[model samples]
Target: MMRAILPTRALVPIAGLWRVTACMAGAALFLSACGATTGGPGVTPGPASPVVGAPPEPAVLGVEMSPERLAFTPPHLEGMDLVRVGVLLPFSGASAALRSEAGHLLRAAELALFERGIENVVLLPKDTEGTARGAEAAAEAAIADGADMIIGPLLAAEVRAVSGPARRSNIPVISFSTDTSVAGGGVYLLSFPPEEEVRRVVSYTAALGADRFAIVAPATPYGQLVSQAYRSAAAEFGGTVTAEEVYSGGVDSMSQAARRLARAGIGSLEVGRALAMTGEDWRPTDSGAFQVVMLPAGGDDLRMLAPSMLFADIDPLLVKFVGTGLWRNPDSAREPALANGWFAGPDAEMRARFETAYEIAFSEQPSRLAGLGYDAASLAVVMAASEGGIDRAVIEDPNGFLGVDGLFRLRADGTVERGLALYTIRRGQFEVLDPAPVRFGPDSMAVDVEPGES
Candidate 1:
């Protein structure tokens, strides 16, 4: 029942059926290729051809992949065209945790083929081993194997390492790195960047007439990024960040920061508590030092931060609370202090369907990043079926494509923009306060202007 929101040309089928042949043993480079086909009644399966090559070495780029790990290759049919998609991930690494994550990403990509009913596309997974040199080697192997398009190489450093080889081969890459610096020149980032989330939520809050803002964030790198993004978003939306506080360390530091922020904005804790005692309603449009406070943490950090603000006597009823995509967790709704707090994220309904489908297919909950792999593979399928094939023009189409994470477009600059929905924590649930836009406007880039830019 899942339908794609794409142009008519993207749905057109390519001429000729194609099959994937098994990787021959003793090949120079060993790739675990996985191909999917849509079989129907009255269609006879074609015979598979043996891909003869040298046996695999003990290790490729210091990452060992045993034959047992490659045994999941599906049988292929002969005399069919092929659209080879090279998926580079840290399949083997010093960290076992990262290897597990890579497994989830690869599984998600494989799931996209069957779910989309794609018959001609084949997935060629290469192990990056979680290093720049490994990623460069993987990219070289994939390019040498005639990959039509490349997906992943998750880390920013890995993306940078793969970019040169991909450009030299005229192959486009859809990476999962959030670092905007690594984007552009045929490397499109499919990962969620904090800038877009901050922009959306801040714009929405400003539209509600909250002009004065305050921020309470941690001192981590992510917090710094979100803080900078918040400032830019606020200025662009005609709001002023009147006060800010950055804390490091544990819950005590966070609580102290919140208290400091409260004093800076509302004078004293006693006054804020006295103000809360009044049964009078406080609206965003009302004149005050600050009408909204931005908290960009998630999980346990969020659990502690939200209550810290409340304990500082910053009444949630009087001051609006805004956050980024990190607030999408169900646990955020369970926190009584966060009730009525607003955050921006993907379309809830679409994400719910995707999560359900992924859980059913994998028998476990998929990680938040798994959607990037699914969407990247889905893009490959659409491009392969299209008349234009997989190229920069087809990929950078202004119309964009809708996927599991909702509507998103790969910009010519290789940065991605997503249509997000505003949600509020309510009654132990996250409820959509503003639904996500179904499509991009004619001038989608108009809102992407940075602060202080003409």
Candidate 2:
């Protein structure tokens, strides 16, 4: 199940259906092209089998891709002074199921080098098979091959396994896992975290005079993370949590929770209308308790919960709705109640541009995670060509790099900080409410005026 095409030099191997073809671009440049195939492995026939060729899972903050759009190409470098880059990915064993997705990631990295025409860099892709042991073996093999840097091992467990080896060798590893626990010790996490999203959006809303906040989250691990993030962000951003509620993933639990939260600012009449079955008389409060309510859910869950809040006598116009990166979906924008709601996420325009370029060059669509490969490789190329190649100071630039998603920088603790923009849900779309800051500072430019300023 492997194929190789050697034009002038042996290029990297890509799994799945791809045909290698090359055409000379210039005297010093050559383009090794590959034809993309949309048809994937057919579903196994059995009672337990899922519907054959069902649509793939919905991608975050991006359009759903059809099989008709899948394509790929392997990049080959041509030069004397080679900057060896070790790429650790799950290419075999149990993780072999993800080979198709991994192919797209590798293609993205190749596209970065091809676009930059970085002839001096050579990519060595190793198979981790998506396990801790596999990751360890891959790292050892990569180090033995003299890789100057490592750029993958997608899962947090895999990253953890490679961290010790990578640190011991003094070879910096930039991982794709979002789990911050695995970060540090020469391994950088490039994946987006919910806590960071909460910090950014909550801070933006708090700066807008929202002194009080409330959170309604599911009783799940992710919900707990968002809950903690809201608490921490509210304190840091000059706000307080007026009320917090966690509910099981259902309408009844959420409705009950909403009723309790609505009681914070509900009048006697509104209370009776919303909770007539309570059989207990209620009176009005200050009505100025919480200025904003955050729901860290998305898709159908959000669509249902938003209306439940309205049904619970909480006026959307009075208390603004705030959400996390989950609200960046196209479906969420269509919710009438979500209009004017704010959330923090990547720059959609730039991300769209990258997707378009990817589709055109590879004749295929890319997954959301593909952006990491491109960004990581781009960072390596820039650093490799700099005065001190891959210098710690250079990679950890405080000013950050302008990526496809927007501005981002690596921290000393191996955590990534992105300059994410605040977006407002509009009618069937999302509008940029506050442009992301270019750098980390109080004086950074904001698209809108400061809170309470006319």
Candidate 3:
């Protein structure tokens, strides 16, 4: 008989009702479900924050459990080999925000097992408590418990903590953290990387004749990363960056950068015309020239800077506003100035299906990061059922694996590559500008269509 060892910490059951249904295609499982539940006092609830080199303790909310769970232990079958997978998450304490949707995440993974009909595998949960020390301890414990592979420890710090232990035990780890710096040494990152997002958008935009690009980003570390990615992608995509500007994240600095961007000959004709029509004192110091202006920031930051561009007489129609995956928000559409702006992100169709299934399975919307768990577990299931059984070669397959977010693969360097699609803000919604490729093409980007397509 299979045994499940629940965490010792008391966790109130999540309040709601959910119905789960699995879509099976041979050994692959796709989930579709119904229902919704808003979090209550007994559960951690918030958006996940980024974790860099080190993360300080953060305020936390109560941790809770769902009354229902997909069976992680498969039914016993004669002569079947058993595969053990471990999941590490922040179940309680300060870092709980990183895994506020643990219940939904677990359910999604379970749905994967159920749909695949893989009964010989077992998934064990370990609480990392949202700390590096906790992650190390949990990893050691999980490995002692006979886990053949490990799924997650949400934050980068936790992943770093668990990496040592996992490597020592010769066990592979698939982390959900987006921090690419922590990846490598048998630790495969399943989280989407900003580099991939930048490359996709840049390449696609360049193909469309928007070869002259300019970037305005914040001066933070993430901003630095984005700047580097923009430069690299520009070169790779045969694009020329006429100007690059970094600001200190202040309104004044952003406004000044906008002034400088306007002087770089970007959309000069339209800028002059718009200024003429506005009858404003503002005049183009130099003819604005770049066809594309990439803003690697989003949210209120974008909202703040977007208008500044127009104030500088940069016409929206003359210059295409390009951004990173951060621009994938409905609110971005509400910004009249950014209506036709483009960004790169996962496929919307797949995201909707996954979200619906998660709500139905746990009676609550899954965390934005929950798909990481589902995809990691799904890959684990697929590998476990294969003849090699989670071999290193299998995990590093360049062809990648299809998940709710679309096609993604792990690289030899432990980085992740996702097949992202281009999207544009249209009518207060994001519309697909280019479908995410399902397979790799000769250009090292995702193919426009699946194999055997006309």
Candidate 4:
């Protein structure tokens, strides 16, 4: 198959999440895990055939990928008899695949390393049972066993649980969790976080020429956080959110909620629920749909909103439809009532890979939860090869943009900042409407709020 996108010198910074089309470099990119070669002891990865089209396994020598700028500067693993690495995943949780996938990640990482002849590392696997307390115990066990570093504790709570111990022991824990708040001086999150999505949405919408915006939000924690990020990122692009509407509705009163938005000349749950019963005309402004609509809930309401936006021909292009990462699937674009539009979330590449890997490994594609497993494991390998004795260039540089599910950078705080690509449902496919990892520098006016500031 394919080789690491080729070891490069340094990344060439790209501008705007939506403006990039390709990764061009000789000094800064390794687009694949194939073509990998090593000169030391390496762990052989297990079978990893994609259900659809996963790139064939790479040559095995036990070499792993290094983060940008930093490299897999082999931290004395070569002639050291055996290098002990820990694997912490939930084996008995509701989602069995997450736990099992840890093994797959180990396989993948080991294969990536095997080709490099770096075979001295041994994985000390443990189960977190999918809880914070469980993760804490597993992490302690790994450290007690002289594990060089730990990977996993997929859940955010678990990431938080294990961080304290990792910090105390200086045994770097590369987490698959995305709770950016869990980040500390020692814990590292490899999962793409919400911040990257925020950056991607704002930068892309600006590139699409959206000058004004608004958000339709819910009064929940997740809803409020995304809304705030959307609002802030929108401002970074010279755009203004003129309105923010909220709904904390139940099924019994869903219609009444829709009616309220109708009265305000805004699309509301009140009006949406009553569109048919009372024959209330659902009207969008002649200027088109509000510049943007940030929908926060899922499971059912989206089916209702789709038709409303359609019959109104709200011009999704005129009014970009912003949705939570929860809305990244066929249902959002299906129902025959909705129009092709834009949204931000787990994005396309993730959709493509997870679907195939899940089926091959477990006869099913993973849901959002499964994503955490993949993110955590992939990130752990990256972090292990970087800051905590496993120096790799890809995970150490500020200018690097990893194109797995999203782009990310190892911030000084031991947490990662994600950079997701933007997608628009075009024709029948989710097209990469906006390329990601828009480089923001000291000069860029992006606001730098402290992590966990909320």
Candidate 5:
């Protein structure tokens, strides 16, 4: 049996609908639902301003229920409508790390429910066990329990497995998979697609007069996707990829690929000699084969690749370095070769607030993907109380919705468009070069097809 935890005070409704507000650590975060617009900092309902020593207070909208207790059945409330949102995750899996990530996602979803203070919607969690078969079973169970919509089933394979069941039942699925192939029809991807990140970084670089570009990427599927995105984005920005290299195996292979890419872009021997003489302060007077080189690797691979570029005489000062969201790590900041490199990611300031709130709510740092859960659940809450309800048109609203991860909108094709910010690595830290756009414009909507999209 499930119990409804009623709010201590009644919420004052806005326009006959409950508005979502997250009061965190002395500040109020006003969030807009799909198709609605609010004014503020990064976009409308901008960066939250501090309320001068005020304590945190949860939003009072309606009754709240524990997700654990309402795992399968939601309690019936007389004269009140209930929206059942099925949350599919790999709660029980062979890999312990995946299971832990699943826990973080669930907790994040629950946090959104608590913060939004919406009692009309119930989150019904079902375990996928990290397999396609398990995902199908989970979807079946969730549907049987009268779920109006579904969230998650993380991997691309699991999303595909659940797609059929969800489509037949006319239930929309907001999955966490970055794979664009499974995105479209009734299933939407809420994950961060590398294509968008690549387009953002490339567009920013190109706008700064970088016409010639090069790339040294891994030979994996992820590498292929990013590499294709690089080509499309460069072309879209009126730039050309002059040199490209792919590598597999260990450090030696990566070094060789980096060497080949650097040598291909290196100027004449006289120029190299002059650069060597200038030492650490060297800046080439002439342009090389390419003005920018994109290294889409991160972590240890990035550490190795950066130095390898130096060994091949690829001066970071001469040729600009660019990367995707993978370069947004603290370790990447420490790499000397990546010091002036640029990358595109979410609004750092807003993301920091979310991290702080999550840590305080859950007593632990959330996984990188946990924001997806928070945003999805938050959207569900707003949609549940929406006059149009959780329909396809509302979910695919061109105006989009604003959440902890900045602003994002689900498209009819099931792809998502996010407002990203540009960051540069400098002095062992990541600094914002360009703030994320507060609102999406006509130009922002005109993006090229993703890797797997036709």
Candidate 6:
């Protein structure tokens, strides 16, 4: 049992522990819950600062149960604590439309744990109907089944529903959704979301000293939001939006949109990147006016639009391409012609190694998504086995980087801190041009230079 170390307000850093001044304990039962051993980070929370309280303002309302206090209790059945690891995914929904990618990943993840000699790892799998409600149902069912932990609900909204219930149950969640918004108590997302991808991309592209960028995406909100995120993040680093393009329904129908660029005289986003390489505070007014093209889509879509873009007299390489984690797939980098395209993702060799281990165990190549599954399950097992599983010190353990996802930490918010690598394709393979970085909230981190940055 963790002794609630509640420190009064105005207390200075008393030997470095986080102090929380609160009304003395009045433990009235709101809900009858069983007690279990509590454990996690024993690290010190940063020092507190004073806040003025003169003016009356709206008070922040909170839910009944504070998610942070929730603890994960492993069930010991027959002498061994058989962790009921629940995997909630859409194995039969629209995800099936993606050719059983989810199932392949799921199996591979389980197999990885099994190979590690962690035999008592009981697998509890459930299928959501590829909808928010389905995801919620799956999560609730998992909790009802005595699952000590929940693995995934793949989508963002699904994560939202899963988070609350998991928190209420004090069950820690390791999700595959990349949406940062889904992160909170009991939820730890591993999907390389747009924000993480964008941050790495902007950091890499910024080093070129070119401050102008052009972005394009489908007409959907997802597309607009990603584009907007890139633009806003780009300017925060002193960059400029010289040109922007919007297409409808993925890059497959972006041919007409490609032509629109010729009129913009934007030349290529690649040129802008090259300008940034000058290592100066070059703005849109600094040199070649404006030129850049950033497409938020996959390599297949990138390929389809290539011919049209080229036929329109647009130099493909001249317009250096910038992309998100979706481009992390080997197939995405296989266009061969996309050798110059820049994207943020896991290290290729790291993925190759994981795939080798997976294939040896399962007799087949693991899906790309499996990497996330492996990281999530493996981390949970290790964390649970630790003296303090979800404690702030453990979650913030400086060394607890999720190897598969590049680098991430379990933050106090119960959300994860992500940092994916910045890679460029060369000779049909992704070469690590820059090391990954920690995602600083919603802001873009400054790009680091390697020994031979050109």
lDDT of each: 0.72, 0.67, 0.66, 0.51, 0.71, 0.56
Judged by TM-score relative to the true structure, which candidate is superior, 1 or 2? 1
- Candidate 6, residue 45: the lDDT equals 18
Worst 10 residues of 3 by lDDT: 23-32
Summarize candidate 4's per-residue lDDT along 266-377 as a digit string, tens digits.
Answer: 3333345444432112222335325566655555776665444444444343355666555566766664433445566654553454444344433344554454444443
Steric clashes per prediction: 9, 1, 10, 61, 7, 15
Question: How do the candidates rank by TM-score, highest first?
Answer: 1, 5, 3, 2, 6, 4
TM-score of every model versus the real structure: 0.80, 0.76, 0.76, 0.65, 0.79, 0.68
Count of clashes in candidate 1: 9
- RMSD per candidate (Å) reads 9.2, 12.9, 12.0, 12.7, 11.6, 15.7
lDDT of 5 by residue, 258-304 (tens): 88887675764466665565222323244788877888989999988
- Which segments of candidate 3 are over 4 A away from where they belong? 1-80, 270-289, 442-454
lDDT of 6: 0.56
How many angstroms is residue 325 displaced in model 2 relative to the true structure, after the best TM-score fit?
Answer: 1.0
The 10-residue segment with the lowest total lDDT in model 1: 36-45
Candidate topping TM-score: 1
Ranking by lDDT: 1, 5, 2, 3, 6, 4
Worst 10 residues of 4 by lDDT: 17-26
Expressed as tens digits, the lDDT of each residue in 374-417 for candidate 2 is: 88887888777877887667677766676667667789999999
lDDT of 6 at 337: 46
lDDT of 5: 0.71
lDDT of 5 at 416: 89
lDDT of 3 by residue, 1-454 (tens): 1000111122222221111111111011111121211111111111223222321112122223333322222222225566777777777737445556554565566655544445566566667778898788767666654678888877899999999988987889998887888999899888878889889988887776666778888988788888888889988877777888888967789999989888876544545665655221222232356767788878888888788778877776667777887887667779877877788998767666667655654556887777787787777776776798977787887767667787788898899988899888877778887898777656444333221100
